[model samples]
Target: MRRRAADYRRPARRRLSCWIWGLLVIFSVAGFALFVLHHNQHQEDHVEQTALETNTKNERVVHKHLNFTEEILSVRSYARQLAEQMTLAKAYVIIAKEHNNFHLAWELSSKIRSCQSLLSKAAKKNEPVSLDDAGPIIRSLSSLIFKAQDAYYDIATTMITMKSHIQALEKLANVATVQSTVFGQLAAESVPKNLQCIYIKLTAIWLEKNSLRELADERRNSLQLVDNNLYHFCLFSDNLLAVSVVVNSTVSNADHPKQLVFHIVTNGVKYGAMQAWFLGNDFKGATLEVQNIEDFSWLNASYSPVLKQINDEDLQRSYFERTKDMSLEPKLRNPKYVSLLNHLRFYIPEIYPLLEKVVFLDDDVVVQKDLTPLFSLDLHGNVNGAVETCLESFHRFYKYLNFSNPIISTKFDPQACGWAFGLNVFDLIAWRKENVTALYHYWQEQNADGSLWKLGTLPPGFLAFYGLTEPLDRRWHVLGLGYDLNIDNHLIETAAVIHFNGNMKPWLKLGIGRLVCSTSNSHYPEKLSTTLPQIINGSMVIDAKGPRRSLKVRRKMSSLKYAIKGNQFKIRHDIVVSIQRKSKREM
Candidate 1:
């Protein structure tokens, strides 16, 4: 029995040995094939193969070209040389700020910046040490470094001031006297007496490039977040802060009362405290209470993007899709180009636990002092949410709307509607129900002929204005861009509204050639240079956009006594008989 068992086991052992040998043979063949492919003696015919090792070695040297350790010192020596050149350029600008040639400093400043930018890119790409690396180029250019830096900063600062104006004004005397006091400063500013008006010219360039008022508004808004107009909300916060101090006392393990108070206030009890009876940990003061912010947005005011046409179809589609259906059309007239823009902003009790209101300002506006006074305003009953325009002040479209459908309102005044009038705050929810925007858009699409003759949308505004004509609770509305020179000081005083009505933009052919920028306005002197040639003093000789041919010239040429310049009028090919025939044809 033992021999029989041994014979069976011998067969199994032989089979296992055969399997192992097969696997070894397969692996050995694969290894030999891989070795033959990898070592690759194919370099015998190719020149690149011989050069590969040297090329790789050179690349490594280039990688460390500007580093502390390197086989080649020239690469690093060059980057250092460039850096030194830049330092010298910076030094020159510091010295030449007041000189007349200060503008020449820009050459050095721009070059330095460009070199730094290009150098950074080359380093990122691991480019080889060469002229492109900047070191060699700067070394050659270093001779001018001393002269260049002298005027650099002065010119740069001058250019920046001409464009970016965040120069804070010192408000002398009490802050309360700001309004009237500011007017004096505006009027008292001395005009430049220079023949060329260089400062004025620079101011125009700045205004054209940047929006000064917009920048100032943003800066003010950011600062206002720390302390805005929220009396009731602030009081509530103060109360909650006091309660937090009380709750923290029992949880702290502080020894003395004073230290305990500080610990409770600063550290807030140990956050991962264990329940007195339970074995596991528990959290204290984890529940958070958040307050609502006062949120407001301008409604039903005109947006130029809605009224303007940009040639870009894709951009138009994006704008159309992004904007909700705030229609710009009236029932009477359909302006094909105008747009209706609106966005939703509301106080959500769950999202913003702090109970309150918020205000959305139109783009063209100036906030004077604190907005606290306006926050306290309330319409009839307890209408906490309000829009000043709805009080019957801001209606251009509203007037037109009422005129379209006389039945919409009995007292409808087509002329008085949303010309500059605003709408109710609470009415936003009600306005969304009727889809009036869609109705206007449909009216516009059906009748649009790309002309401004009819009232497709503004008619409803007039109707609405006539129907609901009431003075706004507070004084604010859709305003013009300082049309009433008496009421609006535009650049000098804080404005409630600076309506950029239609095409009366300061930059346009109108408005005396001024452009509104972020913090200030710019005037164009070159407008005269370009347009003066066209300001003809005599009767027009040629139409501006027509062919140059004159009726008189055509008639006079036809009456000429001699043969005309272009044609022989008779066949020239043949024979001596052609001269006589040609003369008769010319006659």
Candidate 2:
């Protein structure tokens, strides 16, 4: 009985222990599952927080880029406004100086300098400037300008009533006129060093080559010169590059290049260089004849009043040398007044007597279209066909001729329309019948002392061809490319010829930037490339690779070889190839 009781106790104890172990296992599994769920929730929260932070950073970078672009745009706008204001300030300063208001000029200039300083600082800091920063100063300047203008107007009105003041004003006017004359004289006479270098280089090239001496003597197309059936164009110039541009532009635009005849008359000094340039290059089968003006023995001082004027020592001193008296008329000091080339237009009848009609082109002009149609135009018995320059009657006969001279006042009306000389079609038949050369000579003699008119060929030309000029279409020749910056681009493109008839010649450093592009498009002498880098502003070192020779240059070289060798087949092939290449480029 005791043994059986002990076995029952042991079994009960074992069952109790087993139940406790099962509860422990269940608790452990539940705790582990809860821990895993808690960890997964924490990790998901961390991942969401990281994505939000990255998105914010990306947005900040994009916003920064946009802000930077806006700042750049704002800076450009500010700069443009500043430039305009600066220009206005300069004009105001000029006016103040002219009126002897030095205090106002100094004040305005100081303000402008301060504005410039602010701009520089802003630019250095890469900060955008606001136009409003200059607003208060500009408003103050405007008010000052208005006040000064009012004061001047009052003074002008007061002076009109006072006799003594009027006399003083006249004296002041005379002084101002004299000062202006001196300024103009200096401006016109001063030749830039670059132009001098070009002239020297071209002349030196001619002098160096003995083979180029007989270049202009070639008579290959002598009969075509006087052939009335062909188009005859005459140019009188001393500038080799200018002549080249005129010839090149003409030949490039011509419909029938073979029928073109160009007769260039230059001074004795430039004859060799002019001849060498023309002979070295081919003008697309156009006949080019260069004549030395000194060769015409009949164009002596005894017969030509201009030659006499050129020979006068007093005239030479007054024109070529500086003097203490600034009162000399600016026109009197112009070297062009003494140039035989300037006066040669009057002797065109004598120069090409055989040609019944001819077109005269100035060296400064660029032909834009085929000039063959000009020869076919009828003059209706007029000696000259020209574009009238009297849109507002500003360029009337009175503008050129002195109305005080009875010979001019009685013969020509002040309101009579004037014509330009740069481009003209001359009727040699009528010119000879009217003895126009004698008329020109008579007018030239009358103006020898320069009392009748200013010292330019235009005045004499106006007198000689007073009633004999036929008005041409203004589109045929557009003027003011040199001086008028506001000329329409469409007008320039559509015009047959554009004239650079002012001080800002296309070749000069001071030439208008846009106008220079027109001339730069034409082929320049290869030597010009080497010399141009020397004169170009800023850098002294030449380009190591040198300028790339243009396709036009290669074509020109090929044409030159053909001209020398007289290879008809090769020239024809080259022309075809050039035409095809040009067509492909256009396409």
Candidate 3:
């Protein structure tokens, strides 16, 4: 009986073991299935994300291509219109000559000459000509056609000849359209005649013996130049009036004018004029120092990529001269890429070795508010404090760098934000610790062939200061006053500084009318008007006692005086006040 019972218990135990083994097998299979499912889902998610990014990139390329195509089409249309008007004008000129109408011929010839002048400007500037520009010739040609018909001047034959001319021009227009596009892309910036005239007159004044002798006087506040407790500003520029405006505006808006110090560094060619302007003018109680960049014996080809490029004759020709290849990039031809002054901002640490921090201002900027508060802003261990330009996404690293290069692709992010250079608060202590200049040198050496980047100092700035820049509020610096037209007026009014960072400088005739007023409203040195008068017909007459009087001479003098005192035709409020006081006294 005992043996039978033990056999029964053993069989029961075997059944229990079988049940446990089956349960373990079922749970293991379930866990493996769940793991496989999750792995597949993660891979799908990654592929989807990659596809989305690729599509976005393709869309941006397509949009850019569309914009380029539209520009070409508009240019072609304008060319055809201009060609038609020119042909019509030529036919009218022939009819007038044949009829021996001297006055009519002269009038038509004058209109033709004016059209030719406009064509010359359009060709040289690489700017598009509008139908409205040919309005005068169109009207003259229409009136002449009526007169020719009345006089039986073989109008039909003239029309036939004009048709052939128009047809020939149409063919040439196609070639011109392509050339115009290329020229437009590679247009080089040059000093305007008015600015060149100003510079010449200022230099003449600078050379005069005993003229602006006050500039040679030593300042008692010279010790404040490198004072870390004070608000220090550095300006790197060649334009005298621009520097004056910058200094004047800064001084005018400062909370403690005596606490401000400006260190200006310009090229050797403009040092005399720059020094003379600042010396002749007063900026409340602010300290000003002007130094020549050429005096810096250390800043040579061995230290600067731009200096090396300038020393290369092949690079100079490629940058300044027109090339026939349409494939050449536009930025490669920009002359500013070779200018040492444009790249001087990178060497601020070396320029002022003693300053712990600085607020660097571009010559094209105007200060509207006190900037002393900028010094107190915490940088959180960053080297640069700048206004980020990446709100539009066009200013990201991908836009400025050659991402196709393996070095750039592997080391940096394409979508990282970019910052502006025109207005920056640099922490010199942090900058030195990070050796930012050495980093800039390394990248610049890597891009010695101009492959890693295309143009401007901002690209290298982006690389050297990556992850080391703290973004400031946009209100600190408002940009696009030079090129963008649709910026909000409220934003401009509230901004601490307004920057004209593009081709249209406020001092140039090409500057936007409204934006120029905003710049002109800022204070400039009073001596600027007296020292450098307005230029008329490419000549400047510097008469300290004002011009002599005839009825016509007085009229010209009145306009010129208005221009000089009013700061380029925009009358200042202070000038208006003086006029009001004079009227009261006369009454």
Model 2, 1-587: lDDT tens per residue? 46544454678899999999999999999999999978765654554443233223222232222343354344234444455556556656666777799998897798678667766766666654544464455455545544544445555433443445457779999999878766755665565554454455446656766666655445534788889999999999987657777877788778888889999999888777677567666778999898898889999988987788788998788777766664565656678778889889999989987989999999888887888898888889999999999995679877777899888778779988888999899999999999999998898788778788757788788888988999999989999977788887777777888898876676566566666643433322221222222233211111223244344434433442332221111123433353345434443
Q: TM-score order of candidates, best first? A: 2, 3, 1
Task: Let me know the TM-score candidate 1 reaches against the reference structure.
Answer: 0.24
Better candidate number, 1 or 3, judged by TM-score: 3
Q: Could you give candidate 1's per-residue lDDT for residues 363-469 as a string of tens digits?
A: 22322223334444553333223333433444444433433444433443333423332222222222343333444443434333433224323342332223332
**lDDT by residue (tens digit), candidate 3, 93-192:** 6666767877776776776677677766666555544445644444454455445454545757777767876788899998898676555444326555
Better by lDDT, candidate 3 or 1: 3
Clashes of 2: 0
Worst 10 residues of 1 by lDDT: 272-281
Q: Cα lDDT for residue 28, model 3?
A: 99
**Candidate models: Cα lDDT each:** 0.33, 0.70, 0.70
